[model samples]
Target: MAARSSHLSLALLLVMAVGCAAQDYDFFYLVLQWPGSYCDTRQSCCYPKSGKPAADFGIHGLWPNRDDGSYPQNCNPDAAFDPSKVSDLLSELRANWPTLACPTNDGLRFWGHEWEKHGTCAANAFNEHGYFQTALRLRDQLNVLDALTSGGVSPDGGYYTLGQIKDAIKRGTGFEPYVECNRDESGNTQLYQLYFCVDTAGDRFIDCPVLPRGRACSNRIEFPAF
Candidate 1:
């Protein structure tokens, strides 16, 4: 009876360790938001405290996703956000990841949520500062606006075929992206978000799996003007 109890305790310890290890994510989903579509759909958009962001796709969040199309979030309960850790990268974050929510457009709150949820899951691979810096660097490399415009898919309230949008992004990043859209008041579907899959190291882009949910886009999508 004593030997069985000791073995049971060891087994329980191993199971707990495995559960904790599973919290580390396998890859990243770099999500970007189009301000034009966001504001148009929401019908109310405000900029960050700093000022209005440029008419471009902003970084929404860099989430950690698993192979099964699921993602780990809020992995570390004790992971309190420390703004000072990312102070050096604030300027770039403000420019690229501005909060577009209305009534109270606070970038800090957005960042805090992102860090606590997604960033904590990736803490094993990257510290707080590293997680944010990696996202900024990835965003700089993937210029969605330039890619679409250069491919004759300008954002002048014009509708572009889904093929054109995907082709342009693939041509720009050398990897296909996941396109999502939202509808405006006029009932027209507009480009909303773009997501690119990245490896666990956060160094290179990878082809994303078929998303678990259907994409929020029509065959034709409007890249609404901001």
Candidate 2:
């Protein structure tokens, strides 16, 4: 009986260890969202406690996904998000990944959700600070507004085809991107999120292996203003 109990304990420990370790994923989808369209919906939006984010695009998340468009979520629940780990990045995160969810917050909950839901899965490549660090670095280097405006695609409530938008971003980033859209209060289509694939290292951009489904937009979509 004593020997059997010891073996059971050892097996349990090994299972726990396996479950707590970092995850492996094929690639990452570095998603960026436009704040203007987010709030323009019927659900509306509240600014972050830190204040209204910049008119520029903000991060949605650096989601870990497989080539088949499936993804891992809430991986390694033991590795919860710790604000202290990213204390140095709070200011920058508030500006780049601020929450527009209702009942305003200091962005911790938003960051926490992202960290737990998606960031944890990238543990093999990033710690808490490194996760946000990579995202902020990617966002800072690629200004979606500049990418669009530079190609005569201003967000002055103008309507543009999906092709036009994709071409502009491709020109700016030197790679193709997948544009997602949402409906405004007036029932018109507007830009929502932009998806770009990145290497597991979270460094440079790469062509997406599989474009996410259900991101269809009409022949003409609005690039609403902030």
Best by lDDT: 2
Q: What is the lDDT of candidate 2?
A: 0.88
Candidate 2 residue spans exceeding 4 A from truth: 1-23
Q: Which residue pairs collide in model 1, if any?
A: none
Query: For residues 1-226, could you state the per-residue lDDT of candidate 1 as single tens digits?
Result: 9999999999999999886775566778899999888889647688778888899989999999887878788989898788899999999989998898876565888899999999998876799999899999999998888888888888899998899999988887787788888889888899989989888889988887645353568888999898
Q: Provide the TM-score for each candidate, comma-separated.
A: 0.89, 0.89
Backbone clashes in candidate 1 total: 0
State the C-alpha lDDT per candidate: 0.86, 0.88
TM-score of 2: 0.89
- Report the number of clashing residue pairs per model: 0, 0
Instruction: Tell me the lDDT of model 1 at 113.
Output: 94
lDDT of 2 by residue, 41-60 (tens): 99999998888898889999
Please give the range of 10 consecutive residues that has the lowest summed lDDT in model 1: 207-216
